[model samples]
Target: MYDHYDALIFDMDGTLVDSGQLHEFGWSETLNKYGIPIDRPLMRSLAGVPTKATIEILLQKFNLTPTATLDEMNDFKEAWVHDNMHNFVKPTALIEVAKKYHGIKPMAIGTGAYTQEAITILGLCGLDKYIDAVVGADQVKNPKPAPDTFLRCAELLGAAPEKCVVFEDSKLGLQAAASAGMAGIDVLLVHAIENDYFL
Candidate 1:
């Protein structure tokens, strides 16, 4: 429960912003540009995966050579996303939640997004200053479903991993939070538990 937590951590893409679909679209389009094909559903499922890891997995899954350069593909994806943020969903629930808890409890970002991109988007959405910390995928060796990113967020937030609560929309993010010994919020549940549960 969040009431039991000293800090609140959020997964950037799906949990806070509506960029998950854009990310899927971006990756899908980028892969296609490389002559590699990927299904939207599959890329959506891999939302919280690290960039390089996603490239590697997609290459194998698409039977393409592992020669898809991570940096280049990321450039393509970012360029597309940078051109389309206003049209994407804003995941206002996250912004509302952050406003509700900003001063009362420490809130931080633990995401599998590139540091610069994450900062740019969060800044655009006013989340950069709102959150206590932002831990990017590049800052860690292992990303979700590993505890590295979340744990780093907890550490930076000055909260014990077990004393923090994580809000995630993907299974991988949930696994990462659980591995960090924190409670996980499956944000996409249509009939999700109410604020009482978090409190």
Candidate 2:
């Protein structure tokens, strides 16, 4: 099913590796410690959103004034995830797909995760070698649901957006891919990794 594409673009956190749990936990733990109510479902839905966007949404949702600076909250959550990521993250079923396509079609990562975090997770999962480029949240002016990340990835791959396929686990990522004029494969990530739809 993927043969037609010249390049493949992947969303890192949930699509390439199983790190959503750590992210959710980090957010929940940090917010709770700051006396903020936990919204598990919201966090899940906002999986591919950038840290600042996620924080702003949560602040408005809970009607809580920020005690810490936005940078402080972002730093804390990222640190929490980093401290515990090694314990929970592992290669997903899509790693096999990445391996199969490695050195064949060009592959890149376009994620809402900061560049360092995305690179760290890709390295941890041993998927970094398979990818040719990574366009991260810090590098883009707009996050998922906008086409910037994916478009940039396609540019880096020297492929047309329509010739690239995006593997995404979030609705926002799918929207971003579509906005960039690329087809999308929705990698199921609820309880476990499932890429059967494309197989």
Candidate 3:
């Protein structure tokens, strides 16, 4: 089905794994500790952003100065998610796409999560074996919407950016894919269309 593409790149959180709720919980806990109110809409809008970047955005949005540094807040949030992710994280249906093209095409995960965190989450979901490379937010100077993450994945896979296809679940991810000059497939819309086909 992906014969035209030389490689497949996936977004980890909302794309390959159902860890959004866990992330939201982690963010909520961290923000609440600092007395910052939870902003669901803003959080959802920054779906593919890095934890530190998200914290920065949140602080800016709330118009509050933080007692904690961005790195400290990120560490807190990441620690919580890492502790609870294995209990709640599961592979999404888009994982089947990765599996289908596993051996036939090179596949990589480009995520806004930290490198080790992405690896840990993929391991929990039994997806680590299928992925050839992983590019995380910390691994590049620029994260999603800048194309650095996906471009790094393609580089690691030795695939041309224009010849790659990115499977993502967020607008930021899609924008990153486009910026990287790859085709983007929205997993949510794909699943919705698949459901309609069955109906």
Report the number of the highest-TM-score candidate. Answer: 3
Q: Which window of 10 residues has the lowest lDDT sum in candidate 3?
A: 190-199
Clashing pairs in 3: none
Q: Which residue pairs in candidate 1 collide?
A: none
lDDT of 1 at 128: 74
TM-score, cand. 2: 0.93
User: What lDDT tens digits, residue by residue, belong to model 2 across residues 52-158?
Assistant: 88888989998999989889888888899889988878778888889889999999999999998889888888888999999999998887889999999999999
Superior by lDDT: candidate 1 or candidate 3: 3
lDDT of candidate 2 at residue 137, scale 0 to 100 = 93
RMSD of each candidate relative to the true structure? 4.7, 3.7, 3.8
Quote the positional error of residue 166 for candidate 3 in Å.
Answer: 0.3
Clashing pairs in 2: none
- List the candidates' TM-scores in order: 0.88, 0.93, 0.94
Better TM-score candidate (2, 3): 3
lDDT of 3 at 38: 78
**45-65 in candidate 1: lDDT tens per residue?**
777887778787887787777
The CA lDDT of each predicted structure is: 0.78, 0.85, 0.86
lDDT of 3 by residue, 1-199 (tens): 7899999998988788888778877888898887787767777888889988888887888898998887788889888988898777888788778778878899999999999999998998999999999999989998988999999999999999999999888889999999999999988777641211101
